[model samples]
Target: MSIQRIAAAATAALAAVALALAGASPAVAGSPHFIRNATTASLDGVSLVVDFKEAGLEAGAVETIQVTAHLDALYQCVNNGGKVPSDPKKTTISSDVSESDEFTAAKNGNLVGTLTVDPPDAASVLDCPSGQRSTLVSVTWSDVIIDDLTSGASLALTGTFSA
Candidate 1:
């Protein structure tokens, strides 16, 4: 090949290499080093009780009750054994009551006030190319209250996420 032609070809190749290197370097910077996956847990067969006592004029006033729950979960893509997620939010315990009795002082009574409790949060170890990481999550619930009533009052509560 002619000298001028050879020099031009070499310059073109160098330019192409430079462009590829620039593009590739930026892509590497933009690429994420770590990946994440979803995990879930559930607690079943949980139970709580509400006790009632006569308070002044009001009847069947709630004193206190025991609370218990079972926990379960399905974990996915857990790496970095040391790093795990935990729940920082609060859970609530509530109750429901019926007012069919005519002799009841109040149609509905605040048998028990809302009580906030924190439960263990979901955890996972994030696996990454460089290393492992830890993550924490928060759990929350809606308002849980015990209503007023005569007898056979019922209570139900469910877990939820916070806003």
Candidate 2:
């Protein structure tokens, strides 16, 4: 309506945009342009899905998704310090292991859902040096990382399991 009112409104809008950009800019100075929506991330243990919503990856390009985490599992194995698991009845073996799963993401515009390459899940056989076993009794993971191998971009989860 009035000249003064219009100028004040434009200034306020400009200030708001500047503030938002200050917070939303990429961490690195020369980072890629499409890195705006890559902030939020998560890991689904039950479905083994590493999900990124509105990820802001290259619009429809194939992304190589790599996930790494620390794994601790309980197993059942021979009790007499044997490599081969001779028994399957007692759950008396525990080992600290690492599990990493990588897969090529389909061309799905920033919505990345890939299955983890879990050898331990399928094989379930522990060499079981002493108290190791042939069966995976329980599995726990921590320090999870979801990385875009194609773009050399990685997101270290902040919430431990979700982190």
C-alpha root-mean-square deviation, each candidate:
30.0, 11.8
Cα lDDT of candidate 1 equals: 0.32
Which lDDT tens digits does candidate 2 get at residues 86-140? 4454333333333334433334334445435242542345454444435555555
Error of 1 at 112 (Å): 4.9
Question: Which tens-of-lDDT digit does each residue in 94-161 have in candidate 1?
Answer: 32212121223222332323222333333322222344332323223333333224333334344432
- Which one is best on lDDT? 2
Residue pairs with colliding backbones in model 1 are: 41-73, 79-125, 85-123, 85-135, 87-121, 109-148
